[model samples]
Target chain A: MLKIEGVSKLFNPGTVDEKIALLNANLHMKQGDFVTVIGSNGAGKSTLMNIISGVMKPDAGNIYIEGTEVSQLSEYSRSKWIGRVFQDPMAGTAPRMTIEENLAIAYKRGKPRGFSFGVNSKNRKVFREELSRLGIGLENRMTAKVGLLSGGERQALSLLMATFTRPQILLLDEHTAALDPARAELVTTLTENIVRELNLTTLMVTHNMEQAIRLGNRLIMMDKGKIILQVDEAQKQGLTVERLLGEFERISGKKMADDRVVLG
Target chain B: MLVSLVGAVELGLLYALMALGVYITFRILDFPDLTVDGSFTTGAAIGTVMTIAGSPPWLAVIFAFFGGAVAGTLTGLLHTKGKVNGLLSGIIMMIALYSINLRILGKPNVPLRGEANIFDGASVLTIGLILAVVAKIGLDLFFKTNLGLSLRATGDNSRMIRSFGANTDGTIIMGVALSNALVACSGALIAHSQNAANNSMGIGMIVIGLASVIIGEAIFGAKTIFRATLAVVLGAIIYRVIYALALRVEWLDAQDMKLITAVIIVGALVIPTIRRAIKSKSIAKKRTEEVLSSMGQTSGGGS
Candidate 1:
C-alpha cells in the first residue's frame, strides 16, 4: 500500500517563470492495485511519480509506503520501498554493465549490498531464468553489455528489474513512450504480464488512452496540477476514448490540452 | 645496461601500485581524482617520518595508507555532501594535503638512509613484484564482490544504481578511500626504496599514474578486470623503462619527465578521439554515397 498526503511542489517559486507543478495533490493505492495515470503535458504526472520515488522532495507533504514516512528520506533510502522505470531507456539500466551484472544489482534491491560475490552459480541461475522469462534471448548472453540490447529488449529488462525485487510500489514514467509502435506494444504486454505475475502495486504515467483503458484495474486523468478525475475498476470497464474525452471537456470546461493524449 | 634494466623494472613495479590506485578513481569510478598528487606525498611523508621516529617501517606504511584514505574520504564528502564539483573537490583536497603532508613530515624533507625499512637488505625487485602482485590480485577479488559491483555501477550510471536502492554516495566514498590507500601505500614503498622523502616528490604523480593506466589499457586492452589490472601492472613497468631511456637522452633533463608524461597522456587520449572521428566521418561519407546513388536511380537525378 502507498499513501500521498496533500503533496505540493513549486518550481522556481519566486522567479518570473515560476510554475505550479503540483498543488495539494493526494493519492492512495491499495496493495496489488495497478493504477494507470493519463494526463496532458505539464500535468505534474512525472512530478507526482518522482515525488513518490524520492527523486524530488515535495515543498510540503508526506509520503508513506507500508506505514513508513519516507518524506525526509533521500532518494536512495526511499529506494528500499520503491522501484522505478523512467521514460528514457537509458535511465533505468547501466549501459556499460553486462546483462547479468545489472540483474545482480537489482537482485539485491532494498537490501544492503555486502561483500558477497555479486554473481555466483546460484544468482546466475536466477538471472538466467528471469531473463528467459522475458523471452529475449538475453539468457544466452549474460555477459553482453546492456548497451548491445535493443530499446524494446532494454525496456523489458527494466520492467523485470523494477518488479523482480518486488518492492512495495513500482513507478513507471511513460516507460513505453520512447519505443516504436511494435516495441511499445511489446513492452506494454510485458508490463501487464510481469505486474500480474508479481501482483505488483504499480503506478504508471502515460499519454496513451488505449493503454490507460486496456490495462490496470483503475485509471486516473489529470490536468493543471490536479487529479481532475479518477475512474474506478467498475467505471473503467465501460471506459472509451470518446467518453473519457467528453467527460474531461465537461468537467474542466476546456479542450484536452495535449495532442499526444488525443492521438496515443 | 643489465643493472639499469633491473633498476627500471624495480622502479616500475613499485610505481605500479600507485598506477592501480589511479585506475580505480579514473577508470572504475569515472572520477578524475587529483588527490593522487597530494596523497602520494602524504604516504611518503608518513612512512619516512615514522621510520625516523623509530616506529616499524611496515607499520608506518600501513599508517600512510590510512592517511591517504582519510584525504580521499574528505574529498568524497566535499563532492557528495558539499555539492562541489568532483574535480574541484579533489583539487581542494590535494591542496590541503600539501600542508597535511608537511605536518606529517615535520619538515620539507626527511632522510630515511640509516632507518630500517621493509626493504632492508631484501631484494627490491622481489619485494616490489610481490607487493604489486598482491595488490592486483586483491583488486581483482574485490571487483567480484557485491559492493564492488555497485561501485562499478555508480561510475557507469549513478541513476541506474540508485534505482536499485544502492547508495551511490556510500559507494563513491568507499571507492575513493580504497584508491588513495593504494596510492599512499605505493608512496610509502617508493620512499623506502629511495631512502628519503621530499615535499615535492609527489608532484605530477597523477600524470604518472594516468600514463600507466592509459598505456596499459591501450596496449593490453581492458576487456576484463583481471586483464585490465595485469595490463596496468605491466604498463607501469613499461613506463619506467621508457623513463629510463628518456633519462639517457642527453638533450632531456630529469626535470623534463613530467612534461613528457603530460604529452604522453595527451597523445594517448587524443589519438583515439581523432581516430574515431576520422573513422566515423568515412563511414558517414560511404553511407551518404550509397544513399545518394540509390536516390539517383529512383528519382532519375542526384542533387
Candidate 2:
C-alpha cells in the first residue's frame, strides 16, 4: 500500500523558466494494486515517480508507504520498501560487474550490507535458480559481465533483480521502451508474471497506449501536472485506444499532442 | 651492477604499496585522487616524528597509515559532504597536507640516522618483499568481501548501487581513506629505508603511482581483482628497474629522473592510443580497397 497527499513540485522556482512539474497530486493504492500511468512529456509522470522513490523531493507534500511517512527519507533509506527499474537498462545494472554479482547486490536490498562474502555457494545457487526462471539461459553465464548481454537480456535481468527481494512497492519508468517490439513484449509478459508471483504493489509509467490499457488493475492519466483521469479495473476492460484518446480529449480539451503518445 | 639491481628491487617493493593505493583510487574507484602527493609525506613525517620520540619503527609506520587515512578522509568529506568537485577536493587536501606534514615533523627534513629502522636488521630486500606481499594479500582478500563488491559497484554504476540500497558517498569515502592509508604506509618504509625524509619527497608521487598502475595492468592484465593487484605490484618493480636502467645511460643527467618519469607515463598512455589509431587506419584502407575493386568489377561487367 502507498499514499501521496497534496504533493506539489516546482522546478527552477523564482526563475524566468519557472515550471510546475506536479501540482497538488494525490494517488493511493491498496495492497497488491497494479496501476499503470500514462501522460505527455513534461506532464509530471516522472516527477510523481521520483517523489515516491525518494530520488527527488516534492516542494510541498507528504508520502506514506504502509502508513509510515517517508517524505523525509533519503533514496537509499526509502529503497528498503521500493524497487525500481529505470528506463535505461544500463542504469539498473553495473556493466563491469558479473551477472551473479549484480544479483547479489539486489538480493541484499533493504538489508545491511557487510563484510560477508558476496558470491558464496549458498547465494550462487539461489541466483542460478532465479536466472533459470527468466528462461533466458542466463543461469549458465553467472560469471559473464553484464555488459556482454543484449538490451533485452539486460532489461530482463533488471526486472528480475528489482522484484527478487519482494519490495513493498515497484516503480517501472518505461523499462521496456528501449527494446525492439518482440523484446518489449517478452519483458512486458515477464513483468506481469513476476508482479503476480510476488503480489507486488506497482506503479508503471508507460508511453505505449495499449500497454497502459492492457496491464494493471487500475489506470491513471496525467496532463499539466495533475491526475486528470483514473479508471478502475472493470471500466478498463471495455476501453480501447480510440476511447482512451477520446477520454483524454474530453478531459484536457485538447488532442493527444505529444507524437510519442500516438506513435507508441 | 648487481648491487644496483638488488637496490632497485628493494625500492620497487617499498613503492609497490604506494602503487596499490593509487590502484584503488585510479582503477577501482575511477577517482583521480591527488591526496597521494601529500599522504606520502604525511606518512614519512609521522613515522620520523614518532621514531624520534622513541617509538618502535614498525609502530611508527602503522601510525603513519592512520595519519594518511585521516588525510584522505578529509578529501572525501570535502568532496561528498562539502559538495566540492572531486579533483578540487584532492588538490585542496594535498595542499593542506603540506603544512600539516611540516607541523608534524617540526622541520623541513628529519633523519633516521642511528635509529633501528624496520629495514635495518638482516636483509632490507627481504623486509621489503615480506611487507609488500602481506599488503597485497590483504588487499586481494578485502576486494572479495561484500563491502568490497559494493565499493566496486559504486565506481562502476553508482545509480544502480544506490537503487539497491547503498549509500555511495560512504563507499567513496571509505575507498579514498583506505587508498591513502596504504600510500602513507609505503612512505613510512621509504623514509626509514633511505635514512631520511625530505619536504620534497612527495613531489610527483601521483605520477609514479599512476605509472606503476599502468605498467602493471599492461603486463598482467586486469580481468580480475587478484590479477590487477598483482599487476600493480609487478608494475612498481618494473618501473623502478627501468628507472635504474635509464639512469645508466651515459648522457642522461641525474636531474633528468623526473623528466624520464614524465616521458614514460606520457609514452605509456599515448602509445596505446597511437597503435589503436594505426590499426583502425589499416582496416579502413583494406575496406576502401575492397570497395574500389567491387566498383571496378561492376564497371567491367557493364563494359
Candidate 3:
C-alpha cells in the first residue's frame, strides 16, 4: 500500500555541521502489513517516518501511498494520507482540549474546518461511545482535559485518534517509548489490537527488539540510514531478539553499542 | 471618580477584544505572535479611513477584521512556509504594518466625526458591558467548535493535530487570522469611541493584552474554559479600572502610567511562580519532618 523509492535525506546541507540522515533507502509494504523498524539513535528510523508524514522533506526520494507521489507534499497536505504517533505522549494530543474536542478534530480530519456553533449532543454521544471502546472509562470523562489523563491513557487515546479516519498509512514513531513498563505493555497490546482490527498498513519505529519480534508481521533493521536486513512472514514467525542482534552485527559490521537499545 | 470608572469600563470592553486575540496566540496556539502591535493600529487605521470614505460603520469594523486577518496571514506564511520564527515574523509584519497603517490613515491620526461607534447613541458603559458579554459568549461557543478545537490543538500539541490529517499550517494561518481579527476589531471600536485613530495608540497594546490574559488566568484560576475566557474579559476591565483610578490619584504621577501597567503585569505573572515555590517548600518541610519522626521512632524502639 506504500512505496518509498531511493529516499535520501541530509540535514543542514552545505553547512560545517552537516549529516546525511537517509542514504538511498527503499521500502515497500503490502496492505495490512505491520512493519516494525528497529534502529539505534540517529539510525534514520524516525527520519524515515518523518519523511512519510511530511514533517521533513527528503532531499531526494519518491514516496507513493497507493501509487500517489507524496514526497513533494507539505506536512499539512501529506497528513491526509498519513497518521502518526510520536515518542512523546504529550506530542500527539492537545493538553488543554477535552477528550471529546480532540476526537472532534480527529473525526473531521481532511475535512474543511470552518466556523461552527459547538459540539452538539449528537456528536457528544458518538464521541462517548468511541471513547468507551478503550476500556479506560474515558467515555465518562469526555469533558476532562487530555492533560489530566495518565501517559498510557493518553497514548491509547492518541492511537485511537491517529486511526480514527483510517488513513492510508499509520506511522508509529516510538509511540510507547515514554511509558512505564506495565503501561508500555498495555499500550503496545492496544496498538497491536487496533492495527489488527483496522488492518492498517503501519510503520512502527521501535527500540524494543522484543516488541519488534512480538508485534508486527514483518520486521526490518536499519543502520546508518540503510536497511540492513528484513525478515518476511516465514522467517519473522520464529525470530528472536538474539538472532536479530546477530544479524545486525553481521550486516552492519558493528555491534549495537547503545545500551538503551540492548537493555530495552 | 465615577466618570473614570465608567471610562475604564469602556476601555476594558475595547481591550477585551485584544485580550482574546492574545489568548489565542500566546496561550492557545503557543505561538508568540507580535503582529498585534501592528495589527491593532492597522485595524484602527483601516476602520477610521473607511469611515472617512463614507463607508457604513458596521462594514468598516468588518473590514478592519479582514485587514487584521490579512496581516496575520502574512505572519503565518512567514512562519510556516518561510520557516521564520513566529516572534520575528510578527515583528517584521508589525514594522511593515506601521507604514501600511500610516498610508491608510494618510496621516498619524484620522477622526471619525459623525460615524456610528460601538457605543454610539447608547450609554457608553451600558454598550461596553453588552459588547463584552457578546464577545465572551461568541468566542466561547466558537472555541467549542471543530475548527476551534483544531486551533486550540494547534497550539497545545501540533504533532497530534497533523497526525489527524489536519494541516498545522492552515490551522496556524486560521489562528493568526482569528487572533489579529479580534485585535483589529478592538482597534476599530476604540478608534470610533475615541473619535480618532492615532498611529501611536497601539503602542503597549500587546502588553496590555498580555497583562489582561495573565491577570485573568491568575484571577480565574484557569480551571474551566468558560471561566478562563470570562476572567480575561474581567481582567481587562479590572486593569483599566486600576489604570484609570491610578490616574485620578493625587499622589501618583500620571507620567508613570506605563510603569504602573508594567508593574501590574509583572505582579500577575509572578503570583503563580511565587505560589508554586511556597507550595513546594511547604511540602518539602513536611516530608523532612516525617522522615525525622520516623528515624526517632526507630531509634527509640531499638533502645
Candidate 4:
C-alpha cells in the first residue's frame, strides 16, 4: 500500500518559466491495487511518478509506502523498493549490455554490484524461468545485446527487468507509447498479466482514455497539476470516455483539447 | 629496421598506458575528457624534472601520476560542482595545465642521461611490455571494486546512480582523477624511455589514446569491463606495432604520421558497425524462420 499526502512540486519556483507542476497532489492506493492515471500535456503525470521514484523531490509533501516515510530518501535508495519503466524504450535499460546483464543489474537493484564471474547456474535458471514466463523466447538469447531488441520486445524486457526484484511499487510512464499499436497492445496485456500475477501495487500513466478506463482498478484524471477526477472500481468500471470528459469539464472548467486524448 | 621496430614496441607499451587513461574517461565513463592532453605533458614534465633533480625514475613517475590525478580532479570538480560541460571542463583544465606543466619543469624540455629507469641496458621493450600487462591486470581488478562499480554506474546513468545512494559527483571525481593519473604515468614513462621530455610532446596524445581504445575494442570485442580494458591495453601495443610497420615502408615519412593515425581510428570505428550489420542480417533470417514456424502451429491448431 502507498500513501501520498499533500505532495506539491514547483519547477523553477522563482524564475520567469516557473510552473507549479504538482499542486497539492494527493494519491492513495491499497495493496495490490492497480491505478491508471490520465492527463493531458503538462498534467504532471510524469512529475508525480518522478516524485515517487525520487528522481525529483516534492517541494512540499510526504510519501509513505507500507507506513514507511520515504520522501527524504534518494532516488537510488528508493529504487530498491520502486521499479520504473520510462517512456523512451532506450531510457529504461542500457543498450550495450546483454539481456542477462541488464537483468543482472536489475536483479541486484539495491545490492552491491561485484565483479563478473560467470552467472551461476542458479541465477541463470532463475533468469531463464523469469524470461520464459514472458513467453517472448528471451531465455535463449540471454547473451544477446538488448540494443538489438525491437521497441516492443525491449519495452517488455524492460517491464520484466523493472519487476524482476518485485519492488514495493511499479511505475509505468507511457511505457508502450513508442511501440506500434499491435506491439503496444501486446506489452499492455503483458503488463496487466504481470501485475496481477505478482499482485503488485502499480501506477500506470497513459494518454489513451480507453486504456486509462480499461486497465487499472482505479482511474484518476488530472489537469493543470490537480487531480480533478478520481474514480473507484465501481465508478471507473461503469464509466465511459464521454462521462469522464464531462466530469473533467465540470471540475477543471476547461475543454480537453489534446488530440492524443480525444482520438485515443 | 629492427631498432626502429624495438623502439616502436617500447613506445607502444608506454602508449598503452595513455590509452588506458583514455579508456577510463572516454570509453568507460563516456566523458570527453581533454585533460589527457595537459595531464600527459604534466606527467612528462614532472617526471623529467624530478629525474634531472636526482630522483629515482620510479619516484618521478609516481610524482607525475599524482600531478595528473590532481589535474583530473580539478576537471571533475569543475564539471560536477561548477556545472561545466565535460568537454569544456577538460579544455579549461588542459589550458591551465600547459602553464602548470611548464612551471613543473621550469623549462620547455628536460633531457635525461645516465638515469635509472625501471628498465636498464637490456631489452626495454620486453620490460615495458611486461609492466603494461601488469598495470592492465591491476586496473581490471580495481574496476571490480565497489567504488569502481559506482564510477561505472555514474557513467551508465547518473540519475539511476544517484538513486542508489551513491554520490555522482564523488564518482565523477574519482573517475577523472584515476584516468588522468594513468595518463600522466604514461607520460612519465615515455619521458624516461625517450631520454627527453618536451612540454609540447603531449600534443596529439589524446588522439593516440583514442586510437588505441578504438583499435582495442575492434580487435578484442568489449564483452565485459575487464575484457574491454584489456583490449584497450593490447590495442595500444598493436596500434604502435602497426604504426611502426607503416613508418618502415620506404614511401612513408614521419611527417605523415598524423594521417596514418587518423586512418586507423576511422577503421576502428567502422569495423564494429560492419560486424553488427552482418550479425543483424543473420538474426533477421532466423527471425523469419521462427515466425513461420509459430504461424504454422497457430494456424494449424485454429483451423
A-chain TM-score per prediction?
0.97, 0.98, 0.96, 0.96
Query: What 10-residue stretch in candidate 3 chain B is worst by lDDT?
Result: B115-124
Ranking by TM-score: 2, 1, 3, 4
Off by over 4 Å in 3: A15-18, B112-118, B287-303
Give me the iRMSD of candidate 4, please.
3.7
Better model by TM-score: candidate 2 vs candidate 3: 2
lDDT of 1 at B86: 94
List candidate 1 stretches off by more than 4 Å: A262-264, B276-303
Number of the top candidate by DockQ?
1
Against the true structure, what is each candidate's TM-score? Answer: 0.95, 0.96, 0.92, 0.83
- What DockQ does candidate 4 have relative to the true complex? 0.22
lDDT of 2 by residue, B54-139 (tens): 99999999999999999989989999899999899999999999998889988898898987788767577898899889999988
Mark the 10 consecutive residues where model 2 chain A has the least summed lDDT. Answer: A255-264
Q: Residue A136 deviation, candidate 3, in Å?
A: 2.8
Q: Tell me the tens digit of each residue's lDDT in model 1 across B28-137.
A: 99999999999999999988988899899889999999988998999999998999999999999999999988888888978888789889868999999999999999
lDDT of 2 by residue, A1-264 (tens): 799999999999999999999999999999999999998878999899899998898899899999999998999989999999999989999898899989998988978888888889999999999999999999999999999999999999999999999999999999998888899999999999999999999999999998998899999999989999999989998989889889999999998877666334
Off by over 4 Å in 4: A11-18, A64-74, A114-122, A262-264, B45-63, B137-170, B215-231, B238-303
Q: Flag the better candidate by lDDT, 1 or 2.
A: 2
Off by over 4 Å in 2: A262-264, B279-303
- Residue pairs in clash, model 1: none
* Selected candidate, larger lDDT, 2 vs 3: 2
lDDT of 3 by residue, A80-163 (tens): 777878889888888888888888888787777777733778878877877777888998898899999998999989888888
